[model samples]
Target: MNDSDDDFSRFAWHTAEQRAAQGDSRQVADLAVELTHRIEAAAEQTRDHEHQLAHLVRVLAITPGHDSLTQLLRLFTRSQGPGVGLAPRFVASLLAEHREAADLVGPLSERDPKGRLDELRICLLHELILRGVDVDAFPKTIDWTRVKYGDHPLVWLPRRRSPLETRVVFPSRAINSSAHPGGSVLPKEGRLDPPTPRTQERSALVDTATLDLHQMIVSAPEAGGWGHSEAWVFRADEEVEPDRVPALLPTLPMGCVEGLGATSRFEIARRPADEIWSLLFATASIGIGHDGAHGAFGRLWAWKSLAALSDAPADASAEEVEHHVQQTTWFHFESDAEWFCNEIFADYGIAALSPDRRRIAVLAATATD
Candidate 1:
């Protein structure tokens, strides 16, 4: 091998070995990319190319992505010890952050003035909500319109509204004071009557509810599926103290928040709130709606419902709760959501009375209130 090629190979090998030793999966995942290049370069003349390819294959298989990539990096790096270099860690962080942005943006553009301004505000509000922000405290009324693209008249449009931006909206006190904290709109009892299984499968987007809400949210969507790279709407709801935040939503910009029924200038769609809530809640699970019908609204609702329930709390039997509480999956998603929801409710000093108390209070408040 020439000096430069040999130098690249040696550096790649050394970094891979260091990451492997340090147990840095993030580094290892990155090294997987580097090794891809090395394997290509080595393919032309090196006799050891086969061995290198096998090793690279093995590395990719061992790495886990369902869990937080950051956690994966921490565990892998800690296991490998301090001798590992810092370069892989930096690269891993950047790639992960960029991927998250791509997932949220979802083929959106900033070229159109109106679309650009709206997207920016949406992102800014989303950020504020992430930090336990109170948009209600903001003075201006935020207006957003849901636009369709690649559908008839708008097919050639430059900036199209994302399914999400078209659906979720800011909570106005006059409208959504009693809206569900997350995207869920379960009955006052917070219990589903029970879902009867359907016989036929529909479109990939519509029929994707075969898996549980948590599974759908945490797992990657198949090719040409919902096109959602990742779902992170579920935040801890239990930890926020009373008055600290209104609600710790499982997903921010709750999918049901989109398109108010108001006769305002920024009306996106004319769907009703109860209908939107019902459609999303049911579709995420059994994939049904209030009228038990199917439509684009159902699909969108299903997606957000799953995202919301990824953080839904359960009051399981003592034995079941105890057994599940110890499991890694349970600890990560189930418990985390429960704790998050509880914290948010606590922070807001939302009373934790029985369903009877809640129902009476909600009933007492006028629709305007």
Candidate 2:
């Protein structure tokens, strides 16, 4: 097929996958079953053509390692029909079934078990957060396979757990504020309880783990303005004067706010520290992408502004959040510095904003150096 056809095909495939993930049974069943038949056909053809070394290489070249493995598994259970795999495709299904079952549960015995285990754990954790589970109440551990509901392993549960967890999961270091260990959460009373200051203030950083997207805009305007006309602009560097920008620099700008002229706007209000953490983490993990590595690092750079703030609290008063317009190693595209500012402002509002603190500090440090 041509490039356009290929693009369309990929989009269609991804659409199917997304729907399946969201529990669209019809799409999941149809695609899963159809894909299985294709896989079996390819496998049989490969086996028959193995005698021709050139043909084998060609077959292998066209099939990614992950695709080949998935096909093998799908073929084994073909008799159940195409739609069947959707019901019991992975360990999460088992957990959902027997969340309270009594049995020894462990990660499945699979090739590249570590990778599989991590995916499962992340999925479960995200699932929990989405269900409004207070992530802070449960400390995170890497023992996915060891989980048990009563006596049965989590993988073997007959029914999914009730009351799914809803708080988004993110890397712990992302939420570690200089204010305290494991970071501090503001109570509903609007108190400031930060984590103990870090020994190396220079290293303090904020990221997806410490920010919450939902809470940031729950009652705010739909789009945060960047003092620019372009809707949905997110820039690291721009032509405008630094003083004119209205949001955080060096962070992902909220396109929804800027581009769409969202009616939601930031409000100056006290938010629970836990809520802030959940929003950032959820945005970084879920809203970014399925393969969110680039987004993660982009978030890390955004946190660098926070790090600068935390590093020298004595100097926080002199800093301003800065941005470099040119795309560097952080992200590949051009962004709107103004939009970035709007997102941060929309997230926290202007009353409690601290954009200038980091800017002042950076300038002072540069002068000293």
Candidate 3:
């Protein structure tokens, strides 16, 4: 092995040996947490992630518990989906032996889980279940096997008005302002909580996971240029009352939208649901495709995100998502609307009413050069 690899391996094992010899559980745990950042930083700098992660997993497997695992997840709150590279297999394997490893799940609001670290955590959670973690171990709120509300966000299919009329799942991460180009893009108190419109279910069991698209968002070098990611789900129940389908949603940007107001500008008219979701997947950059030779990581996240976020079965497919979307009327926001050319919103976005007509999932994104 190279000098750096030897250094990494030696440092991890030596530290573990020293801590274990001293019989200090707290020291071991603290070192475990510290190593995540150290190894992660080394991996990023040397671009040698696989080997680094293997060593990290080896080191952490010896020190298992609720705190270390919980802290490990907190690291994902800011990741952008595919970029975070810890291997889920090792973590899952460790969790299998330690019953308490998956005990705590960070609040979704805390991390807003945009990348693969969250995905990896989810895969570990699912694997832990497979490894004998009790099915009852997870909260009733997070049904990893079921895709609730709609795809991409909201694991449970709560009543339509809930997210809109409920309390903020996450504290206002930011105050509203036109200067930052508000709307569904940046986090607001009433806006759907980060990752999904979680007005009603802000307290998601322990507040945790799901996301992976059935179709790929034909990727481009600049399509998902570095930027912020946001998603929301709103519902009014198509099977209910006197036509209040579009439920008054929070402020929305006008890039993909044409008119000045949100009400009638980006209207829908029943198009193929999957087609539109492809657009959302593209803009949201769900399941990024950059994984060396293992095909695209998007496909992996599709099922992993599903398993991680809900109780929905592992085999949930795109057709089913379409079945739900097609049940309503969906349409695309054209490129000819009033502010369709706005620079801020111009990066990317998908504003379509779910096929149920009872909800609208507004996903807005911004890209920087």
Candidate 4:
């Protein structure tokens, strides 16, 4: 099919997989059964009933749990008359009498490899965070080999020969924009510098003790006609400890400071931290796919922003929350610099001053012109 069709199919498949992954097995099963009936009904009108009937049978066979088995049998036995042949009866008998159907049909054992890997990574990271493992230590515990090369056939030989050597190695040093700031297409002027040694050290400490740190820069409207922006950094599922924050503030690279602190003129208000560690983990794992590669820093920053602000609802599923964060981040990045500065800061309770006596006439002329 065409690219758009392929995309739509992939999206639908992913959506279904996501629903199934989120412990909604019953809902998925029900939907599958409903679709099977609809297809079967349509097959009756068409000349190619055999293929559609077989497809329906396959659907029933694969559906998990005893409830699905019962539904399958009921659908088969109820449609025994007329053109409905011995195939349904045979399948129904096999399902009803023996354990073969039970063995064949069960909960989803296999899944999309990439999706499964993502889930495993998120879970692994969550467990590591809970156990107070250092962020630096993450590279050691998780199998990057499986993540990067396990599924690809090209590296299969090397993986089979020496899995350790084949594994993708993450750099020991903090990601530095000066060295490799990701894709060439990215705007260099807006890029943040690499993490300083001090920042890296503190980040490790925070990761080991609490949660991962994330930083984002947004332009903020200032007094006069000019707009200035500063980096807003915060930890996932953590509050800014008044005593500790001051010392750590300097560790960040130049122009990288807490958004609230700078906007409130260093008089930031106290807010309790939200339990959004899962949301953070999900967002970080699903980075924005750019230049055929995903940037880790961007994902982390998005995660941190969502977590720090407690933007996701507690009841929302992990997939839903991640989608929301990603959509918001994409929009923010796409917005004009000035609009983003004014809107985001204001939403987060940061005050921006209106332009003073400096240029109403100029502004008026510019607006009119």
Question: Of the candidates shown, which would achieve the greatest lDDT relative to the real structure?
Answer: 3
Candidate 3's residue-wise lDDT over 179-236, tens digit each? 1112222222222212223122121111111133211211221233424444444444
Q: Candidate 4: count the clashes.
A: 0
Model 4 per-residue lDDT tens digits across residues 203-266: 3322211122112122111111122323232333443333343334333332323222322322
- Candidate 2 TM-score versus the reference: 0.25
As a TM-score, model 1 comes out at 0.19
> What lDDT score belongs to each candidate, Candidate 1 first?
0.28, 0.29, 0.36, 0.30
Evaluation by lDDT, superior candidate among 2 and 4 = 4
Model 1, residue 312: distance off in Å is: 7.7
Worst 10 residues of 3 by lDDT: 169-178
Models ranked on TM-score: 3, 2, 4, 1
lDDT of 1: 0.28
- Model 2 residue 158 distance off true place after TM-score fit, in angstroms: 28
List runs of model 2 lying over 4 Å from the truth: 1-104, 107-118, 121-266, 284-369
What is candidate 2's lDDT per residue for 1-369, written digit by digit as tens?
A: 233546546756777678767888785576556667767999998766543533332232234344543443333234244222222222222232224211112222233322324333434443343334443444432344343222222222111221211233432211111111121122345332222221122212222211232222221111111122111212222243333222232222333223422222321223432243233333333222131221222132223322332232322221221122111111101122233343222222211122322221110000000
Q: Give the per-residue lDDT digits (tens) of candidate 1, residues 250-360.
A: 122322222312221110111223333333323231221112112222233333332332232343332332232222111011112212232211101011111111110
Question: What are the RMSDs of all candidates, in order?
Answer: 23.0, 20.5, 19.3, 23.6
Model 4 segments more than 4 A misplaced: 1-244, 247-276, 285-369
Name the weakest run of 10 consecutive residues (lDDT summed) in model 4: 360-369
TM-score of each candidate?
0.19, 0.25, 0.31, 0.20
- State which candidate, 1 or 4, has the greater TM-score: 4
